[model samples]
Target chain A: MSDDGPRGQVGKDSFEARLKSAREKQGLDPKASDPDKRLSAPSAMGVGMRVGVELVSAMVVAVAIGWALDRWLHTSPAFLVVFVLLGFGAGLANLWRVMGPGRMPGAK
Target chain B: MPQLDFGNPLLLAQVVWLGIIFLVLYLLLSRWALPQVGAVLAHRAETIAADLDVARRAKEEADAAVAELTRATREAHAGAQAEIAAAVAAAKAKTDAESADLNAKLDAQIAAAEERIAVARTSALGALEQVAVETAREVVGRLIGSSLDPALVPQAVAGVLAARAK
Candidate 1:
């Protein structure tokens, strides 16, 4: 009788596996195999909004600083051009931070 | 456009007021609303954890009960098998004993019957010899008008019967 224990355990394990798959198919247990993937993935709309905010915020701040510096130094449009390029580069960097392989920002 | 007019003095004041409103809203959300939501979330988490604990314990109990049931069933099966073996052995022993006793009784009866048959055969042979002697004596008396010697008749009958037996 004790010899049946392992066989029963094997049967139970298969039953549990099948049950888990059925639950997953029914949307009851959602992708329980990988918690990290679920946690690190954001909705597409959220991604789009964050990207827009990151790019526009950096650009707006840069443009404001450039405009103020031009007023202070009397060098019109030179700092604006430089800061515009820098802002674009910063935006790209922020995008990389959000969508990079590290997945830190997305996880947060 | 009135909005784009740099000469407007109220634009700066508008920006200052906007900043003040933003700060007030941020403060209110951070101090009151967010914390309340966090507390409720924590409570729900605690409840879920407690429920999960209870469910886990129930599952463990069910597993234990199943194991116990299996063990009992196995034990019972084994016991039944043992009992069946014992019963079969007992029946076989009883049948063997009965057959052996019947065989012994039959053998004794057969031996006794054989002895009775032997006795009957010997008595019949003795009666045949006596009848032969009397029959010869009567034939001799009728032929000769005198009874033959009975002793002589017995001797002659005995001789003939002995030769036939041989």
Candidate 2:
């Protein structure tokens, strides 16, 4: 068959070819992907623990200083009692400092 | 160890001295250490609050910047989509117009081809009719042993040509 002529056969062939090309162009192809995660809790807890340790250290230092002062004064039990109580007060103050803003009960 | 005399006036006086020392220490702490420590703590708290405020403001500003960028990005995306849609629509419209033009051209070509075919067929039929008439005349002349009219032949040919033209 002489199907290469410009009338019946050639027109039908061109229309079919254009239709197939359009369908191929409009085809959809999708792909899958992943998402990300975050970490915050452990780090915040570590920071809080560090602050507590600092307050305790300050209290220990205050107590040691009071003991040394009592020994220097040579007042035996008298200075020891007074200095220890002062150290306790200083420790509570240091704890309050670490706590920040809000006052702790029995601290005064 | 020997028992210390807790009932002795000297021991009681020493105990009273210790109590006095504790009172003095308490007074000193209440007057000096507490205020100084409280002041330091208040200052630190203020500093922390200021830092937190600064951080919060910075975060808010960053958030605002991100929001603005997102809005701009969305707007840009929408604009690009609109542009793409417009381009596609224009292409479709142009394609439709071109197809219509091609269809009209094809129709014209088909009509011209049909007219040419019709003309060719009419010409071929006219030639066939002339041949038939010439053959008939020759056969008739041979059978009758006489020559046909030359003017009648021309007139018959003219009539056949006119009929074919219609």
Candidate 3:
């Protein structure tokens, strides 16, 4: 019975010390990231889709406009060829803007 | 196949239909779906902000409570240690006082025993002196016809006792 006294004291002291140390280690930060700051899997997928949409829209619009202009001016395939390359470049530009380091259309 | 031909009026009709469809889709999106999506996004942002504020307040309160608990625990430990020390001191004081009392009692008993031994020795010597004197008187009376003087007998006994002591 008497021997248990020192052991109990040691256990209690260690427990208190650990509690103090653990509490001291804790920081006051809220630990919640802003919902918009970092993209989750779904949001990242959404962003990727937007980029794809941008690229495809640019290419389609360019091709459509070039085709219509060629027909209207009787210029057979000249405008089509030039606009196709321009649309390809624009698509690449849109892709870069979407996926680049700025992360949220800030590059544009 | 006619789509590839520049003179095909069917291609013009197809282009017109594409524009019409694109316009309708854009109108639907701008009118209905986009506003809904924007509203949902706004609502989500508001909910998240509110949740974060609540979480921050809870975290701060928890930290404060933990800090207070640690403070109280430390104070309790100090108070307990002081109490244990005081108890130990009191116990030691009691033990010392008891030991001192026992030692004084033993000293008194030892002195009383010595006084008793001194008194017994003095009494035994006085009884031996009386026996020696009576023995000398009896021997002198038996040898010399019962006419021995008491004063002379005491003087002779004193002389013999002094010689034996030397």
Maximum-lDDT candidate: 1
Pairs with backbone N, CA or C atoms under 3 Å apart (clashes), candidate 3: none
Q: Rank the candidates by lDDT, best first.
A: 1, 3, 2
Taken in order, the candidates have interface RMSDs of 7.0, 27.2, 9.2
Q: What are the lDDT figures for the candidates, one per model?
A: 0.83, 0.69, 0.77
Per prediction, the TM-score for chain B is: 0.77, 0.66, 0.64
TM-score of chain B of 1: 0.77
Candidate 1, residue B120: the lDDT equals 90
Specify the highest-DockQ model's number. 1
Maximum-TM-score candidate:
1
Clashes of 3: 0
- Model 1 chain B: weakest 10-residue lDDT segment is B48-57
Worst 10 residues of 2 chain A by lDDT: A27-36
TM-score of 2: 0.45
TM-score of each: 0.62, 0.45, 0.47
Can you give the DockQ of every candidate in the order shown? 0.14, 0.01, 0.07
